[model samples]
Target chain A: MDAITVAFAALYQFGDAFAFLVLSACGLAVIFGMMGVINLAHGEFIMCGAYVTVSGANAGLPLPLAILLGALVSAAVGALVERLVVRHLYERPLDTIVATWGLSLIATQGTLIVLGSTMGGIGTPLGSFQIGGYSYSVYRLVLFVMAIAVLAGLYALFNWTRFGVMARATIQVPHMAAALGVDTRSVYSLTFALGAGLAGLTGGLYAPTMTLVPTMGTTFIMEAFVTVVVGGADVFLGTAPAAVILAIVKSAMTSWQGQLFGQIGLLLAVIVVIRVLPKGISGFLLRERT
Target chain B: MSGKFVRGLRAVALTGTVLLGAGSAFAADPIKLGVLEDQSGDFAAATLGKVHAIQIAADEINKAGGIDGRPLELVIYDTQSDNTRYQEFMRRVLQRDKVDAVFAGFSSASREAYRPIVNQFDGLAFYNNQYEGGVCDANMIVTGAVPEQQFSTLIPYMMETYGKKVYTLAADYNFGQISAEWVRNIVKENGGEMVGEEFIPLGVSQFSQSIQNIQKAKPDFVVTLLVGTPQASYYEQAAAANVNLPMASSVNVGQGYEHKRFKPPSLKDMYVTTNYIEEVDTPASKAFVAKFKAAYPDEPYVNQEAENSYLAVYLYKQMVERAKSTKRDDLRAEIAKGDVCMDAPEGKVCLDPKSQHMSHTIYLAKVGADHSITFPKVWEDIKPYWLGEAGCDLTKSDPSEQYTPSNPPSKS
Candidate 1:
């Protein structure tokens, strides 16, 4: 009975870790899946959003309003960054990597300077709640809901909206879309902004769990890359399944000393998979790109 | 007439900008002390006390009519507690702003990131935290308790009290590994057999095998050289699993999680070894405690990190006054002399007069309810691992001074 209880407790603990993984995957899908841009600046976009929310909240703004402003600010910054910096680096993989890397640093430090302090955390109301004789995280449940909404909204936008249709068409055949009198450049810009806005929304929502810091993006960004690349960049929803699988596998690896090994193992496995199947694990699962 | 006026105005504007720039450069500024620490990142929660302590010290110093009548201006950078950010903070402090001295950071990772930079710039950095020791440099002053301070007190306390076979749990990095090594040596040397040892990753949540191994061994006590979320969750789960075994001494267990992990009431009687405690029954310590609680009522009690950082500021003040110069070489020489004492919790914490490291007092405390812990007595004037029983003389009136190498600090 004691062993059963302990196992249940461990499961609950792991469930909390899984919630963050899901959040990271939610951000990764759009940047990698829909628009097909390897956004190195995605993490910066998240960091900017988190910092903006913190600054906004610090300035005595309401929580919901701050979050909206944070996402908007992140999108504007993302749009400006894409226009001035990432736009030039398009089709140049090596150049984009260097450029986006610089942009991440600048965005992180710029936020730090503007905030003028190191510490930032939202006043969240997440307490452990027991349901049906089992412990569950209230905030984790909220995060799950938020991610679903974002995912659903994203699916609807890509399928039902004209702008999103143009985006998908351009993503599928940029030359053909251009020939059909579609402004592909503007589509790219808007798609990039949309991707950044989602990343920001994720960050703003995630800020309550972890405290805000300048380089907080470093961890989340790396996790985003891992999720997007391994989950399959072609399928918009692959990151969801990828995150679930990653979280469960990590849950099982608790006996392997620590979560760090689990993380390292995940990275290692991703590397091996990428080497063997350059198209990612999702490639084998999803026969078609769309 | 328009062209002539525009040219004249442009020249005046250019001259004004240059003058403003040059004027601010030489503005008889107060010596800037950079207080770099993890403010709002992973390590920030654990390191907040240390940063707060620096602020309190700076406030006190200013109230004391400033260092030699020139107020010390503290310019703090939040490394957001990231190792990479720490490097940037180091660059900004040493390369660009060029602070007179830096009193920043805790933990081995942050120290490792900042040490090379400190050496490269030959800038003085006062490291203020207890660490697994075994490093020395000219440009750095370690004011915190060393491995000798932490282990020597705690090891003796654990060995004498329990007399059980020892198994160790530590964080897996240079500091953690070194801490485990020290425990192994102390246990073996002091007539105890270690059944096993394990290293947990910095941010891990799993400790099943470790606990299973511990159950098999059933050692007298476990010493947690671990920190952050890993330590917290492991203890919580371990406790729930009835692995409610006590630690002989938890190095990273004080405010880090000593009171945090327990259920309705926090874990009682968790033995911890640290240099400073909030419950010290001293006039100076009491005042410091009151001041802190009043200033940041929502904040937690004083951890060793804060006390050390606070000491670093005062340490700089004393050194600067004694040396009478802001020159790096002169300040280093003054601190090397080690003739310093202030109203600190340790009651006159000072340097080694030679190695430039502080061999401050280390106390053993047990936590209680109401989020307060008490220290009965500390091993005062504790002999460091580097310092033997017979004592080593640092100052020698010999021909060594003949070199007069033009460097005030010899970096011995």
Candidate 2:
């Protein structure tokens, strides 16, 4: 590969990792960061979204609308799950973990039984363009943009919206927020739904770029969990910075070494970050900001 | 009155015992066939349909009055795609259930884990999945195409059709690694050049760097030995990037059925060689396909693995009939005597007596824009006899060693 092509490849690799981290981790960050609920079923939510996109696209809906519907359906399901199960397990972190893990298994196996283990996937729309004698997909660029947009949208929703304030207040001090006449219960449900909804959107977006299998979530869950863990409990400050660091480290290492070392590099970075700053990168940032 | 009732009950019990004895005398013991497959988990995508295919074949045999009036009883267990589970269950099926023959294992790892257990217990195992090959065991009957059988036929044709430059990508495991070596050997043998080669870790979904490298290498065609669910993403990623070079693969369509899984045009312009594809329009294949569809109307598609499983069950039946008994020693003796060939969906499938591997017709097919397969040529009865060339003689009854590439290509 020529120097320019190598440069372009590196850029593409960085973007790929960034988009992947954002897509897989952003939703879990919401649940784990704000609500302090470890959602082991986060991957399943993403899988559900992917399935919806595939079904919707096959049913003749336009690609964008299908993606939207997939996200919405995931959110609806998330809301329902939160109401029926998660609501009862609040403040019981260990119980929530077991509950969500069980939910993940049920969702995965249920999909397998109902939809079969594997299904045909939708073609990724938009084609490729050449740069420096290298062909790069426009759809990949779309993912990069979508990742940034999701982050920006979530930031605005949390920082500027009234729902965000109530959610923040309810989560930080539920008794006080409830005493002040805020419906803490509804806030928890909405926040959880939003987290799940983001995961669904990620799933729908990448559905076109992957084969649809019931166990697809397992592929994404490891990275999601790692990123969330290293990012800490602060959604914006910790998760975003951690994602960037990890993505850069991963992309560079992947290009330099093979994928195995790239993953190893990511894990090493996570360990180093956590050891240096026990609360994660964002937790350090929050302390400094405060 | 009590004495009379007791005498009547005694008479009835004696008559019932006599009738039960008569029934036992008339009905023969069923031949137990053990089937272990990954119905759920990572391997489910490839092995689930195979379970159904095994069922259909067993049902067909039972309906045909089984082997000489003795019914065939299929005892199946789900291995959940785990090698440990496979090891655990293979033993259970053999020792506890005492199945006459075992038809199981999918991945090369799973096969390797269970191959010895089958031999240690002096059991009959028929492994029927296309693998890296070169396993020669007396107790095990391998019914899949090996690297030489698949790639030797495929690479030469690909070189003739496209140019002599090749780029290869493989999964980082025994099957992928061995297949890549064979690819290298074949490319060298054909006077072709291998411009680039890479081994991808399984479950690495991102392929941007690999794609870039392929473009940089500018090979005439790319040959991927990539496997599993995550590896299937390469097609979509390649398509999205418009990597327009023609590609040939031994893995893609056969096991995972990626041709049917991915949307059209993604797998378009790719070539694959396998023993059976859904598009094998032979009368036998078509009939089998129709029967399968009739049995399970909602089945998505039947690929080579399912067909191979179906063929394995029938091949075992053929062995039993030839031996005239379900006894393991008799079956082994019959197999060792050679000439275990039967007509299958993919044409005549024969067991190489020397190597315990299969010899069968291979179809070189291409993916259409609509996800249908089009066979350009059917390379008939290609004996993987080269496995014997690798110095494995099953007739010697030595199951201690496996064959590996003697002259692996130099890493470029």
Candidate 3:
């Protein structure tokens, strides 16, 4: 392989790792990082999205529309969860972990019982393009762009939108926000739903590239948690940088050795980040600014 | 008064005797067979069909008046793809239920988990899944295709057709690890070079780096020993990336029916060696598939292991009949005679009493671009050659141990 091909391959690896980390972490970053709820059922919401997407596509809906329908359905489910279960445990963030963990188990087993263990998967869309001698998936590049778009869209929503202001206010101080005429409950519900919707979107997008199984969500959970933990409590500020750093570390090690070392490199990076920053990347950034 | 009382007592005694004779003629104790399989977990997709196949076998036997007038009753337990559950259920079936025989275990780990318990009871057991294939236990009968049957045919054919350079991608477990070694050995024996090999941990779905590595190596063919739902995605990713090298496997199309599950062209140009597939067009296989479908109208596919499980039930029946009893010692002695055989759906398969393993007729199945399967080659009467080479002669001595290539028998 030429140097150009090697460079393209390296770039491709970085993008793939970055997209995976960002997509997996984005939803959890919002739910656990921003909401302080430690929602362990985040992965199930992703599964719900993937399941709905595949079902929709199989039912003859177009792929993009199916993905949209998946996100909407996951959002609605998230809203319901927030109202029925998560609402009671908002004051006890630790309790939310246990409750959401229970919900995840219920969701996984429930999916298995209802839909069986396996489902036919959608074929990955778009063909490959040759780079020198090696071929690369066009859909993977699309995923990279989608990750950036999601982050940008989220940034706009939280910084520019009126609802974002209310959500942030509620998250910061629920009683104070309520006193200031913000319906904290609705903000919390909408924010949680948005988080879940993003997770669902991640699932929908990658559904084609993966085997559809009830336990598929577990595949994303570890990456999601590690990214969110390293990202800290600011979804926008922490997640992007953390994803970049971790993706670079992972892809480099993967290129050097293989996936096992890549994973080891990833977790080691996380440990170092946590040890150095203590409160995480965003927390350090916030302190530096103050 | 004495005469009347005596006459009444005689009449009552005669009625009781008649009723006892009627009951004895109608009901007999069922011959219990324990079935342990993953019905609803990770391995459920593949092993669920095996469970259904076992059910069909039991039903058919009972319909034909059962084994010597005793109904074959299945005491089934769902192991849920957990190793601990296999041990727990094995004990329940062996010690508590005292089942006459068992057909169980999906993975080598599960088999290893429960084999000791089976041995402790001196019970008869059948491990019916294709595995890394070096187990030598007196209490267990392995009906699945071993490496000698699978790789010997597949690797040589792959080398002759594809090229002399092979790359291996295997799941990082005992099965995949050992299977990779077999692939290496077979490739070398065929005068092919193992250009590259990677052991992927379970649940690592991302494969960009692995793909790049394979592309860089530019092997003539790739041998994938991937297992479970996560690793199966490699096909999709590889296809999307246009990794156009031919792929051969021992456990792909036959076990998970990847060609059926994945969309067209994902599994295109893939080859697999196995004793059975749902696509086997033989009359016996067709009838067996139809029977399984009839029993389980909603079953996805009748996998390779299901065939082993199906034939194992009949094989067990043969052992029982030959012994004229279901006692472990009697069954062992009968099986040791080396005459137990069954006209399995795959073809004629016989238990090799020396190794306690089945001799299988293997097929080389090729998956088409449109997800169709065609058998281009067949190898008949392939014995567990590796075990034999390792001197795993159960008739001579019961070592009750697994022999890997690196850990061959000392005597050998």
Candidate 4:
């Protein structure tokens, strides 16, 4: 392949991982990173979002509106779940893992029994465009753009907004925030809802590019977990850079060798990063500032 | 005290006498068979239809006065799409339920998992799903299309219609690996060249890199041996990328009814060769489809596995009647006799006495944008000789091994 072909291939590969990580982990980053509560049902939240989009679109709403509705539905569900179950186990992170895992099972099997195994998913909009001799899907590029926008939007929300500032403060010291009359309980619930809403948006955006099934979330969850863990507790700065690094490594490795080696390169990069940097790429960046 | 104890004993004796009388009132007990399937997980889409088809067949048999005045009873269990559960439930079906025969196992690995237990119990394990072929065992019967019947018919047609250069993508498993080998053989036999081949790990859904690589290679057509719910996403991804190359797969659309699940243009123009498709224009197939549709009005579609499952029940019934008993040893001997055959909805299906694989008709089908299948060519009674080619003759000797490719493709 020529240099331009190679470049385009690399770009597409990068986009693939970047989009996957950003969308899947953005929600997980908030729930796991900020709250220190392992939400094993994070993937199920995405699944719910996908289902919402399909149902909404089928129910005569426009596609974009359907996607927005999906996110809102997920947010509502996240809030309800937080109020009902997660609120009781705020300090118990391990317990949250077990609880969320059970929730995931119920969600998965319930979908299977209710919706049936195979439901038709929407087709990917936008046709393909050629770069040099290679053709690429416009939908894939849309995912990449969406991932960046989500990252930026998240950064602005957490860094600029009063709610973001209050959330960060609440997470840093719940008792202090509570004493300051900032209702730590509400903050936790809203933060979890925000995270879950992001996961829903991810699912709605991705529902078109893949076949939708009750078990579709399993495909995205592993990579999401890896990206989040490798990125560390700092949601925006950590997850963005982590996605980039992992995407580039995976894309390049896949192009050079094959799919198996590409995946190995990703896992190996994570292992090496977790071992060497302990606190992840963001931690190392923070320590450098000191 | 003596009078009270005697009165209690008399009551217990009366209860026992009534229970025994009720038990013997039914002239013959039902012939119990085990039905193991994945009802709620990854394999559910492909396997659930087969489970329902089994039920329909058993119900039909019982309605027809059953075999020798004995009703056919199915002890069904959902394996939950877990391979470990296959063995656990197989043990239950064999030892606990003590079923005469078993109709289970969707994937090749799942079959291998439960085969040992079935063999130990001398139980007849009937698998009805398209496979990579080359399995030689007397305790098991494969009533589904194999690579030999599928690729032998489809590959040459693909090569002729498209070109000699082919690219292969398969799931990274025993079935995928073995099936890819057969693709290589067929491509070579038909004077084609395999330009690129990749074995993808199961559940790796993202295929942008792989799609781009295929575009770079620029093969005339692609042969996908992908399996499972996740791997099916490749077609959607590929379609999105506008990789317009023709693709042939025996694995994808037909068995899982992927055509119905996926949006059009993704599966459109895709080629599939199988023993049965819902759109076969034959009178027998039409009648079967009508009955199946009436029976399962809500099912997405009655797939090849479902048809095979329906056939397996009748085939077993034939063997039972031939043996004149439901004993495992007698059933095995009857199966070995090689006189078992069924005029199934798919076509005439008969067991290859040597390999215990079914010999049936194969049809070449193309998927329309609307997910309707159209059969262009149908080959009748294509024996699964791929096992014979591998020097497996179970008629002469009982060998326990899965025959692999004689000349495997070189790892790139």
- Taking every candidate in turn, the Cα RMSD to the unseen true structure, in Å, is 9.4, 7.8, 8.8, 6.9
Comparing chain B with the reference, what is the TM-score for each candidate?
0.84, 0.90, 0.92, 0.91
Candidate 1 residue-wise lDDT, A120-174, digit = tens: 3444435545433344435555776776666667778888899878988887778
TM-score of each: 0.65, 0.92, 0.94, 0.94
Pull out the clashing pairs in model 3. Answer: none
Indicate whether candidate 1 or candidate 3 has the larger lDDT: 3
lDDT of 3 by residue, B1-412 (tens): 2557645644543332111111233277888888888876677788988888888887778777777777787877778788987887788788877888888998777898999999888888899999999998888898999898999899999899989999999998889999999999888877889999999988888898899999989999999999888889899999999998899999998898889889889998999999999889899999999998887888889989999999998988888888889887788787777778879999999888778898999999999999998899998888887887788888788888988888888884
| Candidate 3: regions farther than 4 A off | A281-290, B1-26
Q: How accurate is candidate 4 locally (lDDT)?
A: 0.84
DockQ of each: 0.12, 0.66, 0.61, 0.66
Better candidate number, 1 or 4, judged by DockQ: 4
Q: Which ten residues in a row have the lowest lDDT in candidate 2 chain A?
A: A281-290
lDDT of 4 at A90: 76
DockQ of candidate 3 relative to the true structure: 0.61
Q: Candidate 4, after superposition: displacement of residue B101 in Å?
A: 0.5
- Report fnat for all candidates as fractions from 0 to 1: 0.06, 0.81, 0.76, 0.74
Worst lDDT run of 10 residues, candidate 1 chain A, spans: A281-290
Q: Give the residue spans of candidate 2 off by over 4 A.
A: A1-4, A281-290, B1-26, B407-412
lDDT of each: 0.65, 0.83, 0.87, 0.84
